[model samples]
Target chain A: MKINTTNYEEYFLLYIDNELSTEQKTAVENFIEANPSYQKEFELLKQTFLTPEHIEFEDKVLLYRLEDMEAKLPSTFKQSLYRNEAKVIEGYFNTTLKRSIASVAAIVILIFGYNLMPTTGKQNIQNQLANNTGLPIIKNESSVSVSANSTQNRIAQNEVPKIAQNNTKPSKTLPSIAAEKADNTPPVVINESIANSAGQHVNNENEMRASPSANNTTVITAVNEKITSNETSIVAEAKEAFENINTDNPDRTIYIANMEIDGDKLRGFTRRIGAFIKRNKTEKEK
Target chain B: MTDKDFNNCVDAYSDGVYRFIVKNLGHEADAQDIVQSAFEKLWVNRAKVETEKAKSYLFTIAYHQMIDHIRKDKRNNTTDNFEEVKSNVNISANGELKQILLKAINELNPTQKSLVLLKDYEGYSYQEIGEIMDLSESQVKVYLHRARLILKEKLVHLEKMRA
Candidate 1:
């Protein structure tokens, strides 16, 4: 039987590999024998399939080198969860866990402190009002006390005697007195005290006492005048106090400096805490 | 694949991978690096690669890495010329045929050299070669046949020279 040479390349490969049956092989052989010019090409095609020489090396050495290469590979991938287990645990404790713990602690302390502290300014004003009404009068320098009612009665009845005792040197003005008071008093007292002292200029002490509203206006005008007159003296006293303050006490200096710095830091810290609380509250509301 | 299976894969496939790369690249150091990198990639993606398919996976990786190395070395002017590589092969006294074949193999392009090595040296089927080479089976067969023809022609020419 005649075989087609046109598509014989595939059959030729199968024939060379001995994949064809005996009859097919015989037919391919008959075809090749008949085609004399195709003989050299067929032999070359067979030679091409001949296994090429491999680089010779000791099998033991190659295997050993391959084992060495295997040893160099990482046991696991870098991004694999198994590989990064320790780091993830460490990072949780170091960053996320610690930060959350600290935040919770700060918020707790802020809320507790806020609940304990007084909320309104009215409490301080009420304390001053109580002192003005009937409390014991504490002398500024000596800390000696007299009843407020008695002090007022004595000032009303024996004003001349008190003036004589001081040899008519006008008493230190209210601004100076107010400046010396360690606990900050309201400015209203400064106006009232200065107006009372100006009673001599009006020559009408009973009239000053008669109408409270008129007395308040007169006190305001008198306080303004006193403030203008005493501005230079107040500045001079301030400069003297600043200059004469003893620098020998290092502990006191450090304490005062620390107090000033701590005051500013405390204010800033409180402001931040307040803002944080406000934000959380707003978020809760939303 | 579990770590143990991956390790088993390394033991099973490392030598074959090394031989394939070394034969293709003609540089033992680069072959070692490519082989290790291939195993490392297998370990990285072991979750995605089935244990049975690890051998193919490794060879595929090593083949691509070898190609990349060739391209990179080409750009860097570090690729060894065919003559330079031919001169470096240590031919035994009676190994003229081996020397001629090595020289002939070196003359083929990098891809053809790789195809011939995978098919003949590693005993991979045309389909396996195609999978590793990212070519169709027919394409692999054609390329392998063309590569073998070149080698045979060179070998015949050498034999004629000797005669």
Candidate 2:
């Protein structure tokens, strides 16, 4: 009753589990049915591993329970489908489109109104019209009103006619007046004085009213002086910060020192390391 | 298909797919999420999935999604407390056997594990496993054989331990 290793090992488990193909199954069945010892071994292996005890769910109750549990299990697909459902836009499409068109129209109107500034300076108006229409100012429509107002104001003054007559009388006194004004104005106010030389002496003072920088000159000068002083102190502070920056031995990655080491000092420290090691050896020998 | 048709398919297959996912994933929340994601994919691609093929398609999605979750989670252990195994003594021997079965299943590589599960749990034939896994029938057989051998080995080990 010697069972060959290959046959016993191959068919023993397969025979137990009833997993052999039909022909092989028949062969194993016939063999086991004849031999009680081999049959016992086959049954032991099968019952031990394949018995319902190992897999408790082979019965109808367990199968029914699985069905019941499956029945109770929620449909995840439906939940996901509900979650990803396309959002419904509830209102009428025509209404939404119409509202959007109206909004665009209002934005266009506001942009046009904002560009039509009555009091914008000539240069500012030129820049705005260039920016708005993305066109170079061939003749900026925004500046025409300001120019007309200036011309009308000039006509009302009767000052230009007088200035023309005075121009005929005043070549000798003109330079003297200009020289006196230039000498009296500070370097800080030189730009304002340059603007004042444009029309009549009276007109010169009137044009001075239009100088953009004139009113802010005092405030700008105080700010400039303060900034200059602060700049010198900042340079000094920066120099101190640069000087105080520590450069450790790159290999060591860190160093603690009370005093700062400059580039030259760092080189010196690196060179000293080898000599220092030698010195330590000599001292240890002593 | 209409939303109603889609809903019907969902009703038919959700629980089965969910049970399969729960068994594979072994966690209630992870299984639920994977099941939900699988359904979302079906809903999004409802036009592509037909009613006849809906159950298999749903399971295909759930299986892939479960694998993806497992890959991301990196939890290698496969022994999940039979959330389905409620009362202990009713199937005492069956519980140990089931654990050994799952342990054998868990020892399989992903493709093998999937093939065996589809065959044993879902009752799919070799051709069906091939269709789901995008393998040839011969390839499925090879992997199934390897998986069965591993299961048999584990079963043998369990028997020896019992002895």
Candidate 3:
């Protein structure tokens, strides 16, 4: 019954909970009454214990529903782990893996397509020459010979004789022709008589005539001097002649004789011609 | 524990976990998700967790998850206006003292609110709460005492206003 002043709170809580004996409760009540200020403190402590507990029935229902859902959830832990692994694989395929595969395919196609392009372009140029000239286009190792038919013979007389022939080796390939075109080199003219003979046999005969052993060596020397001296004028005249060719003239089969240009060089030449035509057309429009 | 034992743990401890989380967060959806995730973590380490200590393991996982969520919520400012929302709820009705007490409980910081819930609603001892919350028993006791005093003061003030 001797409630210590420092331990008053301990007794007060016990008194409110009815844990203290009847005598102890009476003594605690007397202590509070003696100190009137302690009465309000005691009442507040009692009210703290009197606070109501809030039970949310709706929350209980929701928890029960959640429990039901969790109970029905798949219990195969390993399978769930495997499903996550499968998701990783699927994600890789959707992103990085798919992009890598597509990139590889694109690179392969580009390389193969680039390699095949030159041969296809050569065939197209050959076909176009055959169609226009109506001459059987003879493809040699380093020369494309279009035999001057009756109509081309007249055009050949005027163009081929003015420019002198050179006894240069007959090793002119298409790539060399592209190099020449790139350098803007002067065009070389073959003899008009050989051009009129047009074929593999005539090319061989001309090769023999231009050889060092030939009896026409003086004629060949004189022709080479004229070609070297008049190169610039011949190039200009040839370019002008090419520009004046009436492409719309149905009767004219323009035979561009053995200018042994390869597919790539031919394509380059065609591109330059196309650009020239485009520039003229644009200029006229303006 | 086997898969069957883990399932049994889920049935046994899920409701307590949900109640503990929901009371602390006051977000039913987040509480359900946290409870489910805690059980999943237990199931992952079921071979290591003893059947008898499964409840403790589950509660520990949920407590850490709640701490992470609170930290994330703080970063996102999701709970910034919580006090404004609490102030708007009218708690002056004669029979609505329960609501007022809950609102006051919500006003506590996440740590204090969690301690109050584990101790009162889940009936966890200070030592058990310390193990779940990763605090020492003495720290749990001190924090729990402070939380109770705050709740007491709030309840007293509200009661006076009603009178």
Candidate 4:
């Protein structure tokens, strides 16, 4: 094949690099056969760029280096183990701290609740006694009895009765049975009527004491059956009057100063107050 | 990639990569270290790197590693007069020609040295060098030509100095 000698200079590097097409390669080969100088230049460039020593060194060193790199790489099982251990330790620390904090908070709450709870056992006992007592008056009686009984138990045998007397006698120090019996010697029916009359008299006295005329007057027959019974009758009459007044004016039972006002009156009063407040606020702004 | 696969890639490419690094760096110890480091990087990216392209990937790592070393050294002191060792150059005549050529390569711009090494010693085509260096093929070729001219000029000067 005839080769283009002039173009060989431009394509010489490509030819040496094995990058030229088959036809171009054949042309370069034929040209090299024709020109010894071109051939010499080719060999010189090749020698300059691609030394045998460097190529051989690269080949041998690369294989050895790669083997070393392979040996340095961690095995799959070791990597997996490392990752798993990390996760497990993280989970353990996170959960342990969380649980510990929760436990500590719960203990603190328990202690706070213990302090907030009622600590007075005596108060609790008194509450129970008051709850069990039929009357409010019996609560004090039970309180005294419990204190006396516990105190008597703590005393020595020789000094027990005297201590019991000192404790119990004070609580039972009201008028003796004989004195009370003597005071209550009146007939049962008379005593009941007296009590009823006394209650009515007390109520009438309280009402009269609050009146303007009471300052100039005196409660001269407070225990007198006639006046007490008379006051009782007056209360019954007043209560009947109030009942009749309430029934007559079912929707407006408020009677102030003989003036019967309904709920509408209060609402009107409130609205007037509110309007006055608004007017005052507007005036202050001005 | 599995450990076995990574090891296999290492076995296939470490020595060549190391020799290439040594040639460029001119230091046997740094070359060996850079080669090991390159393989380690390959091992790290084994999952992303395909076995078929592992050699190119390894060379790419070694190239970057060598550049990093140069940059690091430059930060410490001036590497402006530093020399490169051509992988394919013979060490005859007390390493004078190799030293001169390396000095010439170091004198070339960063892009020129990289382009020439990729093209000549690594045996990468102009297009392949461009892909690795993120430049156009024409740019790589231009830079490579400039580098070769510089080396030739430096060699002539060294020859004159010998005379």
Q: Pick the candidate with the highest DockQ.
A: 1
Q: Put down candidate 4 lDDT per residue, A195-273, tens digits, no spaces.
A: 4433443444445444444332233233233343534444344333323322222242244468654544554454554
- Candidate 1 regions exceeding 4 Å error are A1-3, A13-39, A50-286, B2-4, B79-95
Root-mean-square deviation of candidate 3 = 17.7
Question: Which one is best on TM-score?
Answer: 1
Decide which is better by DockQ, 2 or 3: 3
By TM-score: ranked, best first? 1, 4, 3, 2
lDDT scores in order:
0.56, 0.50, 0.56, 0.52
* Pairs in clash, predicted candidate 4: A61-B15, A62-B14, A62-B15, A62-B16, A66-B10, A66-B11, A66-B14
- DockQ, candidate 4, vs. native dimer: 0.21
Model 2 / residue A172 / CA error / Å: 47
lDDT of 3 by residue, A217-261 (tens): 454344344443535454445445544544233222222365332
Which sequence of candidate numbers ranks them by DockQ, best first? 1, 4, 3, 2
Model 3 residue runs over 4 Å out of place are: A1-3, A8-286, B79-95
lDDT score for candidate 4 against the true structure: 0.52
The all-Cα superposition gives candidate 2 an RMSD in Å to the true structure of: 27.5
Deviation in Å, model 2, residue B68 alpha carbon: 1.8
> Model 1, A113-208: lDDT tens per residue?
543333222234234434442112122212212222222222222221222222112222222332321111233453345334333223332233
RMSD of each: 16.9, 27.5, 17.7, 22.0
Tens-place lDDT per residue, model 4, B65-95, is 8888988877887543223343434444335
- lDDT per residue, candidate 1, B64-144, as tens digits? 999999989889987575554445533332455666676678789988888877766677777888899999988887777
